[model samples]
Target: MGPELPAALRAAVEALLEGASRKDLARRSAQVSNTYRGGGSSATAIVEDADATAYVLSRLPATYAAVAAALDEVRVAAPDFAPASLLDAGAGPGGASWAALEAWPRIAEARLLDASPVFLETARRLAAAGPAALAGAEMRRGDLTQPGEGWRAADLVVTSYALAEIPSERLEAAVRGLWAACAGVLVIVEPGTPAGTARVLAARELAMREGAMVLAPCAHQQACPLAAPDWCHFAQRLPRGRDHRLAKGADAPFEDEKHAYVALARPDVCRAAPAARVLSPPRAGKPGLEFRLCTPGGIERRFVARRDRAAYAAHRRLRWGDRVEDA
Candidate 1:
């Protein structure tokens, strides 16, 4: 955490943020597994909980903190890359997908693939209310284990905190499908653990063989290509504090979502040093604000505007929808 950020890392963020989503989607799938037969939430409850979680995450400070941690991992791993389109595998309530959108800009579109009707419905709502000022992302209800028919390549592919649900046998295929669909890059995130780290490393090898690159958590150097096996997991301390705990009605001090890997592939566009522009944070009174751009370490930086800035800064503010008065 004491490293000085590079310049390329800076531009990589801008290009990415331009394609980010309108709203930040926060999901807590651990609740499902903690209280279910499979230790995962029911499709119905997952969707319901997503609604509550998203609402709480909408709060400026809380949302920004969560988004920053997630984006930091991504930026560090896939610096200087700006994805065009994105696909979410096992999208669930589209939490990770929404986060990706919030980090990128005008992202042509995003496809959410999940087998739960409830999750799909919730995804539609979240995307509909997204910040991009577009028609929201597309939704396709399908299982990652069996992604038949409607499927295609994407600029960016992400499967966050959902791959653990599939059995080991099918996990490979899901990862493969995600890689195959990535024309630009593929990113997969899982819990931070020995087991979780194993899966992430395994996926990293598979994707790299197919032309992807490891953007972060290297902290090692065995050889050109890792031999035998390894783990690529990083954890972020999510201090729940009061505002969020009160909003979610939970008393958790912090959340250790475990180890996970987020990698980049294809790199649909290359604007490593597109422009030296500084983005202004939003006014405190504005609905919301998100700031992002490309960077050197293959990662992006994002944040919701501090409240004090949104007051009277109308045009410069960043958010999903705002009416403009023609002169």
Candidate 2:
């Protein structure tokens, strides 16, 4: 099955509708969407309790799915990484923390940091029924752009879809602060748009310069092989719950959240990196399967013809964002 919100989290989010007006939720949901579309941040959009609820109902599921998908890559790259603590920066409704808890059950402590009081409050309510670790997480108010010594260190640090809010001048410093607090691994996730890819690439470069190892999506720390017109990204298709569909007024039962992410680890904690990662879906034909992969050697297009039965069979099962043993 594809990535999904944990049952507890899904139920908690759905329960939020018990006393809410559907009309207000839909209108506020649209406002939040428009604000983001117009380059505004959640700090400006989520000003009240209703706005926060609307955001949770409309966004929590997709956010959880995207972060979970990214964490799956981390699991593959470093199988032995059993984190005991997590720091969710710019945590909106604590979705990334929930995803981390689901990915690594060993996580016993979590801290969620966000600037919006409304989002932090909403996150607290949603997390009340979540995993024990997340339910007791520390919710702190802070600006990601000005991260300082006040931030606590953790084994797993994640900043999902939050970097876009930092101004260009302060982005590198924000990334640096996050790296400083990362005792083990740091994962940054963004929307899959070209602009989002640019932000991820920038953060990836900054982290690498500070001695961080590229753990996923890239086999080598060298410059991203894909040029501008073409960027690296992946999609996670999540099943929408009834409240989710109604909040957004959408008929589709599922939504595809396209995201671009970079997972980095302190050099000492880096484990077995993948030989290659499938950059896009493989093309299957009667003749063979063509795969575009990111390998240590660089971006390569490899063709496995049906004649190579073993390799073809092994590759046929691979999909976009999957790790490959050979490229």
**Candidate number achieving the greatest lDDT relative to the actual structure:** 2
Alpha carbon lDDT at 327, candidate 1: 9
Clashing pairs for predicted structure model 2, backbone only = none
Q: Output the worst ten-in-a-row residue range by lDDT, candidate 1.
A: 318-327
Tell me the lDDT of candidate 1.
0.52
lDDT of 1 by residue, 38-145 (tens): 455345345553443443242322323333454555554456666677787777656566566666866777788887776677556555555452136778888787
**Candidate 2 lDDT over residue span 32-107, tens digit each:** 9999989999879999989999998898888889999999889988988999999999998899999999899889
